[model samples]
Target: MNTNTGDDKSFLNRLSSIVEANLSDEHFGVTELADKLRMNRSSVHRKLKSITNKSVSEFIREIRLQKAKGLLEEGSDNVSEVAYNVGFGSPSYFSKCFHDYFGYPPGEAKNHTKTESDPIELTEEGKTTKTFKQPSRMILVVIAITVLLGAYLVYQKLSGNPSEKSVIVLPFKNLSSEESTQYFADGITEDILTQLAKISDLQVVSRTSSEQFRETALSSPEIAGKMNVNFILEGSIRRQNDNVRISVQFIDARHDRHLWSENYDRQLADIFAIQSDIAKNVAKQLQTILSPEEIKQIEKLHPKNAEAYDKYLMGQYLCLKRDSISIRKGIEYFNQALEIDSTYTLAYSGLADGYYALSFTGYIDRKIGYARAYEMAEKALDMDSTLAEAYAVLGIVSKFGYWKWEEARKYFEKAIEVDPNCMVAHLYYCSFLDIVGEPDKAFEQVNRAIELEPYYHMTFRMKGIILCDEKRYEESNEALKRSYELNKESYYNYSRIFLNYLALNDEAAALEKLRELFALRPEYLEYKNDITPLYESSGINSVLKMFLDARLELGNEDDHFLIPILATKLGMQNEALTYLEKACAEKTRDIPRMIRKPELEVLYSNPRFVALVDTMNLSPYFQKLSE
Candidate 1:
């Protein structure tokens, strides 16, 4: 049976051709190739493995590498340009892979030029086979020795840096027949991520950063390159009746090698044990020496009742959706979890998150929502002082709702101390630092948060707002644009961009962004027409007066502090002083942020403003900050 047919060769060649066509698309991997071939993923995998003894992902990477090698030989583009042209997001990763595959760095590509007649053949495992004209045995021996030396050098360089031990836990694919079980899979992934994040030695990417790859076609190596991580953890979970099966693979992304894999078949009640085991296994594999505290954190159990834990997981999942309906449902699920497990600290934190989200969405009264958030957060911390999320919720409520600056700072610092990888805590700390007039420290915290959760839109939005506060208009707009790219529907991001454009005096750009903002938040349209015409006819001053008049027309108590800023912008000194005095007297919620507004800078010289700022008791903190 001469089964190695021409058709087999054609099929393999077709796959190679397709990969070459998309050599620059980092997203073109196994699933995408399967779609292009009009076959199921498993079918494509089986056929490719049968023909070439290589997985589709491996095949694609090889094709890209071959194309990259050719590009480098041409000497037209530099290493970085060639790396990107061949679809490698990271030039360093590309160089590493090239050196490993070709036995030389990309920088020396021109020196090792090969002709069409002397094509290099790659074995099933990506080992380089002999060329058309074989070299001497002595040459082969020398080349083998060189590879061994390279491998050892790489190991030594990587082994010494435990602090560089970083990994991204990709969203586990739900293999269950019921699509509703996807949330359970997501929760398991998040649980492992949280456990890993507690370890001070490892930099675990946030769940949000990995969520985008839930159904992606990108390979582990490609994703790691994009995130600049050394490893990746991916898995699939299947739940059937009272039993569950979880299969996980840990990959050394730099080498595109599977370091370890495990398949667990257990009763549903053992889910927590599975999660804990996985986290412990990952740390052990990375050679990370876990402290006694880190070990305890990893081994901590979820709600003892499986059903209650399930409800809590569902609640956590829904809360991340961040819509009004999802938040309400999440709150209900948290309550259900509490009904079953009265002392579940995670459930309390989830409840706090839902209430805080509802407050932002205006789904509940702000005071009531914040009060509930604070109460639940306190309960969570009462049960588990190590709970970072609870402290983050408390920090946010204390700062924004109660205006307890020192208390908020303490909670935020506590949250980060308990879990250094707590991206939310870092984000809150950045905001707190900015409000306290420590812009440099604020930038540092935001950068740390971005490293932990690069895909999170809020990180960019916060940076944009902070830059706007500092009057770095161009940089502020860039950050806001990045935020907008990540989340097109975010009204707050658009608003910040509008402010940046206005500060830059790019009136046309400002108007365009304002229209987009108005489109997203239609309530602002009520006065859009009233101000647009005035802006062109009577200048920005008239526009400011009209906008302030419209704002004052609302007559809402919350609008009190904003009226002062608007009046100040319009150069109505007495009016601004009057509104500021009233706002200070009322202890308005916006008072903290209002006083920091650049528009209020003109009022800083006014004795009434100085007296009001002094009465707030912030002078000591300001003086301390200056010191």
Candidate 2:
């Protein structure tokens, strides 16, 4: 016998009211109840607490438990049917809950609801037994069925999730030692990422970031910290011969607890179905709010040509690398895929990515390739503008080609809007904000990108740069170190670490670091500029002249303004005159804005340079630095 305190009774009554109002609709939850009751979210949450003294999740579970118990008692269907009918994504999860809630597995609780919704038709084997006193030929239904069903229905009525935005999909595990099969496992995971990315409400972390943890031994909370997710949808895939076995679990990362987990073993031909099922179940478990458009997008299928689809996935895998060499390889593979199936929108998207990469990597003149890249992206968009990659690359072309800052922002934002989980959009958007001088926003976006892919060196390295710009040099150094430790291959990352050290005025340490950076890239201008501060305070301009010499040899007129400023600061007016003439000849952009530059400190008192500065409309930028 279960007895309730006063608080529990009040909760039961409120739940009963909710059930009466919304017993038919399956989607009702805390958010919905709060809305119907016309109360604030926290207020409704408080009332639910006062009534039942149960957390919303517990109430939901109890409701689900009751439904499962009722169906078993009802005996209208077998165990699988009951599980599905009662909205349990898996019979195994339902049974585990049933066992926990009722002290018996669902199999034992079956056949009890058959005689009536009230009477427990306890089954001896499969059918309900005649009665408590008589062992009839009919099987018996379980007794606890009615109570459980009623409780679950009531729970469903009171709970809701109203926000149709945001999601976090956990990384898929690979259960194979063969590296070849790694691609398939990764393919399945990326496939899920891509599918979920189609949802405008969902955020999907990039597979590069997700895959970094394939070997992580971190706990759920640690993983969540690394991924920066509200919830995690983790799964495992094992491909043996032609069949695949997959198991997925959803965890509330903040709680470090599992919400749901299930395994699926299906034939190769049913792979598409498997992918669809995974996405739907994840959304259901998280109680994700999706618009009708998002729901439809979530259900879209892979290409019909299976072989071509495989090739296209390979192209996607390569293109996702986002480097010069890999982008070309991706282009080759995408072409191979499209040759097999011309209508593959994904392949078109991949090709668009390749051209976009070429433009940015300087493999082609951006001026010439901008329209082509835009055209290719438009084609993919025409076929499917919802593709996150296409949107990201298209956004970049808008930025660099037309200087359409707002339009570029809209596209980048939409790419994230399409999939909040996209690391690319998160990353590039951070840099874009940096360009607009929003260091605070840039700081936030880059940190988010780092959180999404902590183990990925590039993302971490980028976070270090943004952090440095935010004057968080200590934090920036840590990020760069982590990045270097992970990917020991990039010399450029070390150059950055050295720069951060210089910024922090670790001069003794910086001197050695400067040597290291010069060893990595002797041509790096940063090395020459590293010693500028030594003379900047002393008003000596010769301190960093190697940089100016290098710029002069490069024949860039912009160096003219820099040289004259340096010469005047060192009290060398003749040298200043030489460079100022060069600057006036070219009318360099920096020359027009000389007051905005510190390099011109040497020229402040020179009459000729002062007149030149006035002529160049640079007076406004000339205020001397305060001590």
TM per prediction: 0.64, 0.51
Tens-digit lDDT string for candidate 2 (111-186): 3332322222212221222322111111001001111211222233234342322335555666754333444455
The 10-residue segment of model 2 with minimum total lDDT is 134-143
Question: Lowest lDDT 10-mer window, candidate 1?
Answer: 135-144
In angstroms, how far off is 461's CA in candidate 1? 2.0
Error of 2 at 493 (Å): 4.6
What CA RMSD would candidate 1 show? 22.2
Number of colliding residue pairs in model 1: 0
CA RMSD (A), model 2: 29.5
Q: List candidate 2 segments past 4 Å from native.
A: 1-178, 194-208, 219-291, 364-369, 401-407, 413-421, 436-493, 496-506, 516-627
